[model samples]
Target: MVQPVSTLNHPTLLESPQEWDLSTLYQGFDDPQLTGDLEQLQQTAIQFRDTFRDNIKDLTAEQIADCLKQLEAIAQQSGILYAFPALIFSADTRNTEAKQMQDKVLEALTSIENQLLFFDLELKNLDDARYAELEQSAVLQSYRHYFYNLSKFRPYKLSEAVEQTRNQDSLTGRQAFINLRSVHLGEQEYEPVSTPDGKSCSTEAELGALLFHPNAEVRYNAYGSVRSVMQQHNSLYGYILNSVAQDHKLENQMRGYDSTLHKQLLADEVSEPVFRAIMSGTRDRFDLWQRYYTLKGQALGQTIRTCDVYAPWDSQPVEPLPYKAGVETLLAAIADFDVNYARRAEEFFLKNWVDAKVRPGKRGGAFCWYIHGKHSCLLLSYTEDYNSLFTLAHEMGHGLHFAWISDRQSYFNSNPPMILAEIASTFNELLLLDYLLKQAGDNPALKKTLITRQLEDQLNLLFRQSTISRLELAMHDRATQGTFDHTFVNDQWMSLYHELCGDAVEVLPDHQYDWARIGHIYFKPYYCYQYTASNIVSLACYQKYLQVGKDFIPGYLELLSAGGSMDQVTALKQYVDVDLEDPATISAALKYVEGLLDQLQATL
Candidate 1:
């Protein structure tokens, strides 16, 4: 039998670092090396522009490759320069020095980007004969995909002067508004939540964790307290959302894209049909989502509410999974999949590359930030429940993906597109789920909990993410026609929630303003759909692993290793023989969820 949560012992918990060691990036913001690197980056960027500008059309294939190599060096430097302060600022959003340094770095990088903007525009504007000649060059083979992806933007290419103006204007334009949303969220205080112990103050992260509180009233009130803050500042958030959306719409008009979604998918190298396939397939399976929630309510002996969506099935508070235990569990799962994969992941923990502390002013959600040639760092407020454990696994999956890319690819290909980005992370979660389920053995409660968690995770990734993407489509459409306020956004969100939930759960009043808290809508517009797309891909990949066993390892690693070096669809097909373009592929992913739902029902 699996050990009880309360009795599971991990001695290393005492020695594990709570805060990440930023020393890997720099000693601190005050480190002279940080300053010197910024200076060096500026000098290198200037030299690049002077040498490459107005000369791309005259360069040979070898010269073009040399230019790209220099550009990649500049990009690597800029990645480190930006990542250092950005990671620090994320760790402590209230840190004035870190925030200021981040702003300075962003401004400097934007200026550098403006100076180098002509190179890409010139390449995009190259005559068909010249572009085809370069495309066939053996010397340029390494960067073939890179330039092919760039050429997709030719229709959207503005003149150099116009593009430069837009690039510089963004500091005060859309970007300034995005930063405002971040800073505003980081500063706001949520009302204290009443737990069984007592009434306690909460940060956004703390308040979020309470949604899983074993007590129904606590979950409801915590949800209200979190949303009340958003409702209170709904006007300001509405303005920020509208401003960002308007900026996107204006740019779409200027760049000649049909819509914001079109522009985003182009960058992702994902075709429109595949996007529609996932969204449509997900919407068609709303019944499975509703069925899971109904089963959850039955198991918990209460009507489901939005707040109770994450509540534990048992009425007992779950014992915290200490950071050390979480890391060990995660590593063991990966190691089970392949020892070499586990070895790559061990570096993050050994090198102190993760910040897993819960603190005020830290960012609320989790993210893995990978510096091109250095390493990846993860930031998450670890609340130490099963959710946090899975989150740890998820982000480490991203860290490992970056590690593979860094090991095998050039700096130019290190960053995968957003569509391919979440595959490793979600795949890691599945591995953890499988490991936990196997460990559960004849332990019914443990098995139920693990199965429920997996089902809910799939629901969120496949259904809720697509709902958010649908909302983005609606909001952006409204922006194109005119402007939308919080009221319209709220109504649309509730409508979509009702459509998806289908009376399986109670959609409360406060749930209407939930859109305010979705940072991606304000920051990234149409980015949420990528999670849905990736979840589909990862589920399919996991199924292949099950069927083929260890034989799946090589191709899976190759997919991650390919990084952004190839288009995601091509990589998926060539590596794993998974055709994302097929509607059956998407249906198969939903069927996988249905199979999990069947298991959960059998346990119930």
Candidate 2:
């Protein structure tokens, strides 16, 4: 039997320390300059396309450089084009104007993209030796990385009309399905979960916190409420997931991709064997996950249910950390290794570069949106819990990466590859954790809690994602063959959980529709494993930091500043001294996890 929750009220949530000032991007939806910028992009794109469409191959290298400059000018302003409406919708999804503007932006950009499509297509068609000469010229040297990477897709190139068809249909294809999923989720309002205190929560963020509630009964109730809500919409979500996967399947066949994951690997610029190396290392360490979960079960004095996996293994929950305190803590932690990181982090908060408010109709999770090619703005729905604070730091980490790389790399190489995108964010999280642990000093209970956090994050990032990658691979392969359904997803997902997480936790029935809720897989197929890859890579970076201290700072920062100047594997091997292809690197990272388990076991 569960202990009765107290029949009394508790503090709900603290006010957000600050709301983001989006003026850094633009003043608002109606800013006159917003219209001016969009018109400017249209004028620029048209002029460039008309000037270069028939003569890209015949143009001098200097002329090509001028064309690129005009193109980048249009590209830079696109931040306001998409980011403005996205910010509006994220804050208030019910706003019809915002929704209309989002549609408007997509349509407008599609036209501009359609106009610019010939540039790359025509360039790729240039005689191989001629293209080489162009790529090596002084004017094109900075864009060398861009042209070289673009060439890899030449084998998969289609006619300009076909490419335009693909681009146009995309608005109605997988992207539309993803939008439907987001709307479906955002529309849901879970029925309130009754508490022993007679209080209740129905919001996604609030109920999510209850999953880690100090009281097991509260956690169970919250979990039941969530599962019940998800069950009502399971078929809708299932349809969404199925349709999205099938979209990728059709495209995969069209493109002759090796498999669904092969395209992602190509985009990520990593090889299949290297990708499998991550999976293999995590697969070999099932014992470690089992041990950790078993210990957590022991701590809970009962079988660990899926709901209890993230439950705190402590005497009681820690007090919610304030937003201001969270910001200060993260800044101080980062200051030790790189004072500049702290400065960038401060700029995010100080310059109105973050949206930290939490309210109805706002998106559920945190994200860092890179504005233009210059800097990133963060969107966060901050709760008082430390985990939420970690979310803040995580997004800020992405902001710092964008800020650091902005001045160093041209727009062509400005964005980091998806595989390395999470590294800086995860790195920030590790440093924040370490700083918090040190701040705990001689408090054994606090240390245990910190260790528990470390384990949970590692298990999810390093292990669970690898397992999810298997499910994604299976789903895409099956979707290609046909007749895959919700039941099929449940079976495939459960098999992965059992194999990766073991029987240390019970898999409840409602958890079967898990695939329905994942936005990443739906948005970008075979995209889930980067979390696993990045976690292992970040852990290895942290290990080096411990061994070399501040001396390691320059190399790590350089890696971030390098952006997409080099592929992920080369960057890691050169800067962090770890190779994705090296199984030992994964094992070495696992050692840090093992040390945490050892410390937690000692406390027990």
**lDDT score, residue 126, model 1?**
91
List ranges where model 2 is wrong by over 4 Å.
1-15, 194-199
lDDT of 2 by residue, 1-604 (tens): 0111222221321245566667766677788888888888888888888878979889999989888777776777776579888877876666778888888888889888998999999988999998898979998887877887888887777779888888898788878888877767777777677656586788777777788777888888788776776778887777888988887777777877777777778788878887888878788888888999999999889889888888888856677777766666777778866776677677776666777776766777778888755467788777777788788878888988888788687677887887678889999998888888777777777677777987998888888777778888888888878957777888898788877767788887777766666678787866778888888888888888899988898898889988888777889889878777788878877887898889888877
C-alpha TM-scores of all predictions: 0.97, 0.95
Local accuracy by lDDT, each model = 0.86, 0.79
- Top TM-score hit: 1
Q: How far out, in Å, is residue 309 in model 2? A: 0.8
Worst 10 residues of 2 by lDDT: 1-10
